[model samples]
Target: MSAPYAIPRSHADWRAMAESQSFETRAFIDDAFVDAASGETFETINPATGKVLARVASCDAADAEVAVHHARAAFDRGDWSRIAPGRRKKLLLRLADLMETHKHELALLDTLDMGKPVSSSLGDMAGAIACLRYNAESIDKVYGEVAPTGEDSLGLVLREPLGVVASIVPWNFPLMMTAWKIAPALAAGNSVILKPSEKSPLSALRLAQLAKEAGLPQGVFQVLPGFGHTVGKALALSMDVNCLAFTGSTAVGKQLMQYAGQSNLKRVYLECGGKSPNIVFADCKDLDAVAENAAAAIFHNQGEVCIAGSRLLVENAIREDFIERVLKAAEGMQPGDPLNPDSFMGAIVDQTQYQRILGYIRQGVEEGAHLRSGGESVETCPGGLFISPTIFDNVTPEMVIGREEVFGPVLSVFGFDTEEEAIRMANDSLYGLAAGLWSQDIDRIMRVTRRLESGQVYVNNWAGGDMTVPFGGVKQSGNGRDKSMHSLQEYSELKTVWMSLTS
Candidate 1:
């Protein structure tokens, strides 16, 4: 499982690869790639160039029904669902191996498709391979429970897979997020249908072909690429789909819940929006280190992360010094060509997001939040949807920029006088996916961490964790975790089997 692809050393190397890249842009159903039912195709644009890379099958409700039909047949036939765990594990491992083998191609596709820097795309691919391998290895290790009972009776608690799972992933971190949902769902022995975001569906489609090559049974794993309203809604409302796992906005998450409720009451697992707060206290041993981490928290991946630490809450004791340090760190993260090896940041996903992020920047200014550093687009990468890393100081909890999930590289800084005030400001948002705390005081760290309303908290750090930790949120951030053993539970059902020994 060592790194399978050699890292491209130059922008020319990456550009050559992107120019020659051949994408699989059709709906993969029942182990075959086919055209949409209506013969309609949508352009998969390169956000960095605003050019059409390929014409992908624009699947609709009819296509969803066909794929679901195949998935249901495969599940009912026990081709994958009832297979031995070891066999399933082997298949998934082979798929992971195939993914590793094609890591470079996948990385290039993601970069050209979504505008993330090539290095970031490669990093995401590595994480994706690890996540898949971890879930595959866990498939054979998990054991059912033997419930205690009197000698006259025997009770067993069994974990069984839900029939068919539909995973709707987001555009940001596309490959990684797809791995988060599909790995666990497939490991749990469920037939999975991945409905990746239309904005970036190239990697998912390629992975489907790899899954087929890995010898997964027909219809066991399918990729239906289309818009959420038609294909996503159809899958959510499908009577055959037993569980629906989604990672996207809170509004869309809510719509999926409604779809679930209106149809078959399918189990819905969502990892939605986050306006995560990074609280820095004066007791922090190193302001410089904290400032570096704070900058990376929001600027990495062009700040298109769902659990990004977009809110910066600083204790007033060292507010001026720390803010200055953070601004300095941000200065080095201007957007550039995604293919360039040295580019720290890349373009926004698309024109819509580009304009949306710009709108937020304008709103922040109009609402009186001081534009400290970057607040506009950068011309360094021509034709790319590149926005400069933006920071807004003097932000209030009441402001829209502070309250909403911008999903861009927009950092909103707020000043606080005490630990209580920092905690209050951090928890005032509607979302609670993740939060960060920087302090050397052990007692205050523990006390403040206990009060922060987030699923994952990083102390003295911004974001650094492996796939072993659970990732999810509270309140409006959505429910159910995505990684680790907890995600396995999301795709499985527990049942009790009681037997009378006396009989």
Candidate 2:
């Protein structure tokens, strides 16, 4: 058998890589790196070691306005907004090329800033590159429409770029998520203002430079690094912005929609939080495989995933057996230094998130959920924001751990008696983002796939999808699809032209 995964790098190698990077901390505005208008900056602490990495520009309302004005001017100028679709495609592909060329640097930055395993960030770079290339290639292929018209008149339906789009993305998967939001917007010819979460801003800063290198025009793309309340709120409330697309918490997503209504009522699209459910039936072909997936679904990325399968619902016949296997698999998911390429898990994003996860663990205990394994913070990495991979058994839908999103390495497990009961329990949540089911019975597969109240569903697996599929959620999880041809429509508006041919 192959040896277990380990961080390939030595301590000296990691120390060198960490010390080699320049502490670049500036806002990308008007295609230039500049400080906040008020000259204020905030410390960007490394969650892995509780050390300050850099002092990033702390952009507030005024700085956000600066970015807005710049983007508006760029949009109104029509340089990128009215450029040939083929040309826009070329620029985006060039940016993707640059990103791929610097993949290692980008991956290291993400590992240092957000505390994700370096191995995973490398994978994220691949995804981000794919998203850019996919949107780039498709830009020129998508065509406008001609509506049904009488012989004497013409009705031409056109798709035009929405002017000055503001994209507010979260900390986890920062670079990839930013690419998902902006690639289509940029390809469709919109000037984009990106507000990356303050918790992890390094990759975004690097991305801005790459965009410039790839020939994106001044003000066509910008990055503002600041608190969500400041730059994030400003972006949503800006009258000059024609659209606001956000990916973060469901609570924050709702606030953005309100801000949109309060301001220009710009079109809003959101991909928000989820407490996804993963169900396994007794008839599975292999319980071992199910147990492996169940562990990975919740433990990957240290459970920072928005669609992490935090809820595990197993049929009563195999519930006890499955929990034992899941615990065994979760043993390999210990938190380690992010720079170690082999580490399966990394530090929590921050102290606030760390404490929040611990609070949920305590709540789970109070609610009488059995602590199968892992409950407290590990002392291995004393300064790191590290929480052990935790599992709570016998969880009910009403418990806080079962209902709310902890967004950490925590799993809540429940047992169901029937397939119908499992479906009911899975659908009985405030979220409808994604769900997974495992069963060899073809009829059961068909029935469960149709009944799960989520945007995406998985059978015999969890959280695997291509760039071409639509991904988003229903209900409080937020709205609008994020990938495939549907996302292209999100950045463009429909305009109909009429001509009187008989006159």
Candidate 3:
């Protein structure tokens, strides 16, 4: 279904929305919006204007204890877990409908809170809504299985919900990531406590209320908006939390796993950092298409994407021509005011990420990598955290910029002579999240894709997949899948029951 709200085209209109927009600044627990137990709050800033958006509740250990208590109680009481799959499906469907109705409001929250373009924020809303709907529809369709057994015996394999799930999501794609974690978890009848990134929690807070309105049971879903050191750690260390689903940096994912091992040995599913490689061969059918896709692979969402194709490996025969085309494409994506629907690129998520990206650019220059284009901040929007799409050429695989995940609109280009060399360079990193390959020869495509050490590979295109496919990574990128039917398994447990019918 199409988005129901009319997008505001002008900057003035969006500015007005920002001025009049009401925010949910409290924690959502036990079906109510309340302040943190310690009554502490933290400010969420709009990177575009460097202005305070709202003071969200800064939940700590005490607040996490309370939320987890309620969540466990709700799950044990079977308020939701014991409900019929059809009933859960209906409620989730209602929540999706509510989200669709408030699509513009939710989109505005992300735009104002984290500085993505309003248009892209709207697109995020659509994707989030679709994810919710897909999981909701799958609720009743998922069925148990009967195993082959002796004539007098019966064996049944059933999928059951884990008790309590703590979902820690990142700020880059706040609502979308939140939906990705919670939709299937909730659909499977698990009680969920969401810890959204302190930088972007408004959309998640609002989503909790919508879920409540959609008839989710008390404590079935909760939102705790706070820092990772306090609320997030508490949830991770809680013995009562049955599973933890997280999406963020690789370092944080490792920490969460440690916490899980130290506490309940709860299931930990993570989708973390990526420095995906986009390789273009000499036999590419269209240089222009590949260049355009290459620009978007790194520049989309200001390149805050975890699976962004930040490393470009082009065959030497076509490196010069392809690089020129890519530079022209990057030139068209200059940073602009996020509220303007015409704008493609927006401000960085916050000042911290902005500084982090700049540091990487400086490191690239200091390391002798050639800065081909855009390694400076844009001054068009004064006080805005905007960075130009930066490109660095002659980047050796060992350089810091080439190895680490900058997580910004920075592209590093490398030239390779042979297919083996391209594959080797692409797989040199610790991350194996996603990769892109541009080649016209079918045999070469099959041969190269099999050798790439990545979870997902896009051939002849970039980032070309949908909800039907699984999204996750290997190695340091983390061990979890987010979309499609496979993700449901992460939040569920399998059980076998045997019965003997000897009369």
Cα deviation of 229, candidate 2, in Å: 1.0
- lDDT agreement of model 1 with the native: 0.91
Q: Write the per-residue lDDT of candidate 3 for residues 1-503, one digit (tens) a residue.
A: 45544555678878887788889999998999999999999999989888888888999999999999999999999979989989999899999999998888898999989989999999999999999999989888998999999999999999999999999999999999999999999999999999999989999999998898899999899999999999999999999999999999999999999999999899999999999999999988779888999999999999999999999999999899999999999988888889888888999998889999999999999999999999999875778899999999999998999999999999999999999999999999999999999888999999999999999999987888777789999999999999999998788999999999999
Better of 2 and 3 by lDDT: 3
Ranking of candidates on lDDT, top first: 3, 1, 2
For model 1, give the 10-residue run with minimal summed lDDT: 1-10
What are the per-residue Cα lDDT tens digits for candidate 2 across 243-362?
999999998988999999999999999998999999999999888888999999999999999899999999999999999999999998888888877789999989899999999999
- To one decimal, what is the Cα RMSD in angstroms of model 1 from the true structure? 1.4
Ten residues in a row with the worst lDDT in model 3? 1-10
lDDT of each prediction vs. the true structure? 0.91, 0.91, 0.93
Clashes of 2: 1
Model 3 residue 47 distance off true place after TM-score fit, in angstroms: 0.4
Off by over 4 Å in 1: 1-7
Tell me how far the alpha carbon of residue 433 in candidate 2 is from the true structure, in angstroms, after superposition. 0.6
